[model samples]
Target chain A: MTAVAAFAWSVLQDALHRKVFYAILAFSLLLMLLIPMLPSASVGVQVDLLREAALGLTSIMAFLLAVIMASTIIPGELGRRTLYNTLSRPVRRWQYYLGKFIGIMAVVAIALLVSLVVLLILVGAKFGTFNPGLAKAIFTIFLEAMVLASVAMLASVYLSPLVCILLAGLFYVACHVKGDFLYRAMTDSTNHALLRGLSGFLYYILPNLERMNINETIAHSERVFRVGAGELVLLSAIALVFSAIFIALGAYLFERRDL
Target chain B: MEAVLSVEELHKAYRTRLGGPRRQALSGLSFTVPRNSVVGLLGPNGAGKTTTLKCVMGLVRPDAGKVSLFGRDGDAVEARRRVGFLPEQPYFDLYLTPRKLLHYYGRLSGMGASSARSRISYLLNLVGMEDDADLTMDKFSKGMLQRIGLAQALLAEPELLILDEPSSGLDPLGKLEMRDVLKSLGTGGTTILLSSHQLSEIEEICDRVIIIHRGREVASGRLDELLEEKGDCEVLLAEPAPGATSGLPSSASWAEDSGGKRLTVSREELSAALTALIESGASIAEVRSRRLSLEEFFVRRIGKTGWEVEE
Candidate 1:
């Protein structure tokens, strides 16, 4: 456990040194602050509009950070031969793999927290009200990003970073649309057996990422669909189980491959 | 002597390209590194030295045979806890300072904070990087990185040390310092298995060498014994009479030396060459069996054709 923590700490320190990390955060915050100046934003419910735009910016920032870090950390270390020293120790390959996954999560969590704080300050100053309810949206974004990061990391062991990113993007779209699109494809009487079989397979295997997108629900002032604590707990359970499966599979494959 | 590490009939094959035929990297390779001795692993580029070390470190899985470390399987984490390895041209994250980097590795090696701190200090000073220990390694030269690599390898105070191309990027003075450090470590009872292309470095620091060619052990023994010529003798002559040229044996090869002219001949032709020199009234300066340098011995054993092919 100490070995895993040490590796995780190293990843945090290494990520802090990269300019891209700060660049993405700064760019997202800058864009968020500029949202109120838009001409169309003033015509509607201003506070709701501001909240929606800010949450959208924060989600994009968190997703980019999670996917990029998860995709590159392993392959970059392998390319630089830095892993030889780390893996040559008494530490097991599983520890290194798990530690890196946890590290990526930690970074994503920090980025989301910082973005949340900025959004809160902007809302308080613009609307003269402190709405703590925004935590629900931020938490769901975290859960969704965790799922994406795990998939990206699993792909990274066998594919390059660019390919991993592309695959993760495709997976996000497939998983989001599978709940609706694949259901129709699977049940339609006109569909061929092979096509139905493939859709069935994908629908059962891929995690439902769309369920975690509660941005609009929390952004609107009217609680049309309130995100209750029970829903959050169930979502957390699903995301944790799905991420654990990907991590375990990734670790198993990494252990067998020659470094 | 007890053996610290032993490899038996190890074999590994790597695919040249995806879905292509496998190329043999190690074929029935076997050797043992004795405890408390600095053993050199000498071979050309494609001779599988790195592959052998990787197998011992459990980085690469061998297709056949076994590696035992102090009576345990090489792949066991317990066995690896007592071993330290430095890869060829080691690289570290440039964002980390030497202190931070060693601390991270020390923690991975299971050292406590206080002990890891002390060990980091000792290793930094040992590798002559204590002055720049806190500076980020972004601008460090290759030699500086090599020093830090050595420091990290020693962070665990391992009983056995394996180094690949330890002197690959060092200057003359840095190489000398590295040799001195290694010699001190050998004296302090750390068994070392070194792989290098610098024959002189091996000749100076190693007591024994295992020479492998084409992934098989071609020679393994004490250094001096291996360099001794079996059936050759060298005869040196001082100033001689003008007619001495006519009396010299045709089978002898002549090469001029700073002291005088020297003739190299086989054991059977040594007596005839001496008698010819004596009859010609030339003074016999010295007579001894030909001594081959490590470089000369390596070329003779591996052949010039093999060397060119490796190049």
Candidate 2:
């Protein structure tokens, strides 16, 4: 096999040696259990509940997985001095970082898909309808999770794991309402062109969580889904570009560091 | 033998907790190890031996100067394929047995699945770990872990082998066995570079020695040549009369001996003393000059301050 393929396999195998897979299983069970315990007054409230629950489940699990995984990758390798062993191989420093990125992303994707499947089954049992749109929304959640994971990895590579976890968690929470923060600033009458441009800068910097979110639309049929294929494609490209840049930065810092 | 590994003017440093500038760990250190030779890197604690190895492996980039392997520049990925490093206190997953661990590392070295599978058993046997190959690495003792680590380093059949404190936690017999093993590996045309504080251990296996203290290489060369250059050697008397002890050279004063027959002495008076003793009625069963062990010779050169350098 090629070096890149071998590196990817190594990263995946190392990750599995930890109980990362088991923890994901436990969380999936929790999500399944929550399906029958919905506190809803009416059918509309119930579907809204399921939609919120499913989206929240996928989002929360993805967030936790990324934070947990990214928090450990660099620090654990350094702590064990395994980073030295791995880097001593013929693989490039960038390949080491990118392989880790891909491995963690693959695990997150699997967890997201599995959680979506379980939630869909519950939804099918309760309402006699399995919403394909929910499945689609879960896919977007995985995409957003990839963005969040990249951000987390970038922070972890530069800062202590604690600081990385806090910063990444804060961004994950704040980005969910990033659109509202920008809109509030944009509509304020007091703002001039310069302030508006700065606000716009901040807006574009934080991921537009609203664009990728198809959760609320699935619940309220009147809310038109405005996302186009072009937007999804663009957003994915943006996430990937950001991730690559972040990973490059990580590799550069790691290269300069004395294990 | 060509210099398979050369470190020139290397430097590194760490920042203190109290907002300070970089504190240099390595200070213009330089040396060369001939190919296919087992060289001992000797130093006390905090002597920068580990730092040197890390720099050579590119785990820690030097702030200044260069480290080269196989004529290529340091930190070059291409150079790494020919190198294998066993860090101090190597930790694999506690859950992985030697069988699994070797296979895992082989794959990382870019071997195919079938190849890795085939090489696993072979590497395990090479380390004398064939019996415990099926046991978890964590369950094995420190000596076993080190042996398995050796296997991993050798899995790629590297041209240059760098090991740091490889026998730090072995029993006397284990150490002896390990030295023999390393000697055998050296014979196979793999240049081995290792660091340790055990003077006897290094003396036993190394063809050459490099002594580093506080990040600077104080001495390095062929073992016998280093002793000669540094003014440390022993005088072995044949069957000199008991009264001859009083006639010993001042510099050649009696030193801590092995058996009653073995005695250490200074370099200057060794020839004259041996000639005079032979001329006398002392029946020369065996008369030979003894060089100081690598440890004592290293200590004599460094003056025993224990790796302290000012700036």
Which number leads on DockQ? 1
Q: Interface RMSD, all models, one decimal each?
A: 0.7, 1.9
TM-score of chain B of each: 0.89, 0.87
Query: What is the Cα-based lDDT of residue A259 in candidate 1?
Result: 79
Please name the candidate that would achieve the greatest lDDT relative to the true structure.
Answer: 1
Chain A fold similarity by TM-score, each prediction: 0.97, 0.85
TM-score for candidate 2, please give it: 0.90
Model 2 chain A — which ten-residue stretch has the worst lDDT? A219-228
Where does model 2 sit among the CAPRI classes? Answer: medium
lDDT of each: 0.89, 0.75
Q: What is the lDDT of residue B13 in candidate 2?
A: 78
TM-score of chain A of 1: 0.97
Clashing pairs in 2: B234-B265, B234-B290
Candidate 2 has an lDDT of 0.75
